[model samples]
Target: MSEVLLLLLLLLALGPGASALPKPSGQRQTGPQRNKLLLVSFDGFRWDYDQDVETPELDMISVRGVKAKYITPPMLTMTSPSHFTTITGRWVEDHEVVHNMMFDQKTNLKVPHKETLRRTEWWDTGATPLWITAQNQGLKVGSFHFPGGGAHYSGQPIQRHVFETPGFPDDNETEWRENLDTVLDWFSVEDFDLVTLYFGEPDNVGHQRGPDTPERKDIVRQIDRALGHLRRGIDARNLTHNLNVIVTSDHGMTTVKKRPLVDEIILNKYLPLLKLASFEILDYGGFGILTPRPGREAEVLESLAKVPNITAYSKSQMPYSFHLGRSQRLPPVVIQADLGFNLNSRLIVYVNKGDHGYHSGEMDMKTIFRAFGPDFRQNVVSQPFDSVHIYPLMCRLLQLQPAPHNGSEEVTRALLVQETDGASRLVSSLLLLVSFLFFFV
Candidate 1:
């Protein structure tokens, strides 16, 4: 019994080591084995955009790799919150990036686009992003214009990164090609293990001219060409087999006319009924948050309930699917406009032609997700999933332990191949043997 107890202790000590190395799912190698990853985000790329537009590069990736018909972004599908959620695998509520422009009443601080990238507290908030996690594990990570990629978390930034400054020129074809070239250079020269690339496209054009318009389709074509450049560079470097590539988007966009949902409802009918502390019109006109003064919360909710083309929810009454309302950053009362409608604000006169922050359940809010690489299964089509699950998949590909996050491997398990090496199998068997002996000896 004493000998058996000692053996059990030894097995327990080896448990962590056994799980440390991931086993290759198979011996299939299309090219040189390079364990690298690239995550690309095409801002505002809708799930169904490909139906109308021709995206040869994206289509090729889908043909050669796994394609998810759609990826449902977390609720309040704004750019900053959605992108942060993609990297952290945490809900916006948990990550604390509740909105693109975060307003903290305690400090009277408003984080605009210019300041959003610089504010560490608004981004770090204890949750570790995938880049940081990889870096912590001694993997070199790089980023080009990815949100939260420029900022330092736990006193460390990605080894290589470039941030777009406020008021930078819109990315034309030349700039897009340059961006891809830079990424390829980093991969070849710097030998980064994980890299992220962001493109603000169809989102910008989609906002100026509605997503359904030919103008947005033109931009999509341009982005598709840029993707071709990236693929060509990868093939040139012979990294196609070794490097995994995932292309996705933060949120989808929808056309919004000047319906003035807020004016006809909140301003005309509800404003007089309550004492308001502050009201924020967020994400073009699709979302709003209302903070009632002390003792006026009930009145605010009661009055806004009658608004047309809008849905209102008290913080506590928010839907479980949203996964919001748990943070202090969220306002007491939340409001969202119905599809094709937008909230009107007295401060802003120019309304965006396209908008997104509506409920994620809407099909218009869905985004595209495609991946190709050694770790991923090829020639597959998957059902829709939340973008938050992306972080876990990235961690799995890079062989890094993920930080605490809302995503689960079960959500992305089907996209991956179950490759185990002989060593991994041996360790797994030993673990099973130890467990069996401990239980039945």
Candidate 2:
């Protein structure tokens, strides 16, 4: 199919559940501007888990700055897409990273002559991330291994560095500190305005060891310690005196109780009205995407409405808060198998541990967000915040213009220091002086 027609097909598949942009609120109000900012992405962290344990680094940040109690991400709640939203202020449709694995259109013989990996440009389609933006604005940008950071950032002049290796290790803390040292080393020679670091142990360990497992608990503590080390590193450089720090995550995790197995024939028996576009036979059950053939969408929708152990949604029916759009990468009819039903397979497998990609009821779906710096206040606002909002807020804090994909509402004023009449008076005096000087000249 032609590229235009293919994109249209994808948009139709996204259905009506795609999210729309929200109205602008004056949440990006300026504060006493800061000289630098640091963002640390703690992948796959939950808002509430192992509650008995204390997050001292985060708690310290709260005491010094502000903490939003919760930060929710868009549906599918995966890493790449959420990270895209968090940094670019766009949704899955705009970013074009609908899922972890890009579609292999060449696999279908119908497109036998089609080019491979051509349409699978997940990293290329989105708006420039914060690092790219900062670099373009003549500010130094440094990044550790984020999901999409390794991809070409439209040839932007941002510094990309890998401080940590993938997969979990016993000495994750050591790796984290080493990465901190690398960031510090770079900062020592360069005056970077924005820095991004990512710690992957928590997410990896949680997925393998389960959130309730002792191994996962230890990993969380280690992550907290790493954050402490990070703070010390910043303190060592004296950067904190005028810098802003943000801690956040991409998505949360969920637990699986029993893997539900479904026969392809049995599933097809009930899904006659729907045309299955993609199918994966997973350990717990199956993961699949469906669409209506030709004009049969209404029948498929009605059939999905009657299905149990499944949550089916049209593209338009998706939560508006996510801000997704009708794009070709999406399926018009989406199906989320019942919680705990793992689609088991050798190549595509879940570790039978606590993981994500289930329902909203999963605690692992709740992520984290905490910011501290000269521009923020010491308020503990417990209102739930969206992960997508962090990108826009970061730009606002750095006093940089936002990218075209920024669909998020700016953070509320409660997160920042209160404006004062004294500053206003100073501004008035400066304006009056400039006006007088202009007239005299």
Best by lDDT: 1
Cα deviation in Å at residue 136, candidate 1? 0.8
RMSD of 2: 13.4
Clashes of 2: 25
Q: Kindly list the per-residue Cα lDDT of model 1 for residues 1-441, writing each as its tens digit.
A: 646765675566445543422632323222233378999999999999988888888888888889998999999788899999999999988988888775775555676765787677778787789888887777778989998887888887678888885687565789888888888878788778889999888788888899989898888888888888988999898887678899999999988765553333334344662245555543356887767777888877777777778888998978887899786678888888887677654434556888898888899999999998776777789988999899988877777778899998778877775433334555665676678777977
Off by over 4 Å in 2: 1-33, 106-120, 163-171, 259-307, 314-322, 343-349, 359-363, 406-410, 418-441
Writing each residue's lDDT as its tens digit, candidate 2 over 333-395 gives 666666555443233344456567665435558887778776676756548866667777777
TM-score of each: 0.85, 0.75
Off by over 4 Å in 1: 1-34, 259-269, 347-350, 419-441
- Residue 421 of model 2 has an lDDT of 28
* TM-score computed on alpha carbons, candidate 2: 0.75
Best candidate, TM-score: 1
